[model samples]
Target: MASADSLSKLLRCPETRQELRPLDDSKLDELNEAIRAGELHNHAGDEVEQTLDAGLIREDDAVVYPIRDGVPNLLIDDRIPLKDSD
Candidate 1:
């Protein structure tokens, strides 16, 4: 995975065209846990069934683009939208 500093400098959200920041460790861990528990979802309201190794959350916290194998999957369809936890 790219270092947080590097990601912050280089990555942007594919959907909103806004800058992205690497999720902090605690937040990353929480998201990963949710992924493992089958709790993650996308904007389309579909469940995210894959593991997120790491991610860059949008500055507005609206969505997260997953990073797999050190590559940020910034495709719009790949974005995981942030949702209120029930």
Candidate 2:
């Protein structure tokens, strides 16, 4: 299995095909907060119940794919949309 750093270099958004990189720690904290608050949902419209162990974010920061057990779940329907901030 490839290391997360190497995998990130090869990963792309399944829908937009944008380059993906490991989501930064600060952003991960924010994501966890929303998840704990029962406020985040995936593209499939299901509430994201599990706190992400890690994640990959697209270049534009529009969405994130959760990484579980060192494997990225690249399914389009599993992608979580990000809220825009002013």
Candidate 3:
């Protein structure tokens, strides 16, 4: 996997065109907790079935795109909204 710094330089939100940064560990943990508990769903309304290895959070911190096995899932329907969470 590319280091966060490298990924940050290359990735952007497909919808917003905003720069993205790695999701911090604390937030990743919280996200996984929600995923494990079946409490989170993607914008597509499908339950997210796998825990993320990493995530890219948008510059404004409004959403995150999941990275699994070193590949980013940037599909619009797969972006998880951060503003709606606790």
> Could you estimate the TM-score for every candidate?
0.76, 0.87, 0.87
Q: In model 2, what is the error at residue 55, expressed in angstroms?
A: 0.4
RMSD of each: 3.7, 2.6, 2.9
- Give the alpha carbon lDDT tens digit for every residue of 4-53 in model 2: 57866888887778999888999999999999999999988899999999
What is the Å distance of residue 15 in model 2 from its true position? 1.1
Better of 1 and 2 by TM-score: 2
- C-alpha displacement of 39 in model 2, angstroms? 0.6
Residue clash pairs of candidate 2: none
Q: What is the RMSD of candidate 3?
A: 2.9
lDDT (Cα atoms) of all candidates against the true structure = 0.78, 0.88, 0.88
lDDT of 3: 0.88
Residue 25: error of model 1 in Å?
1.0
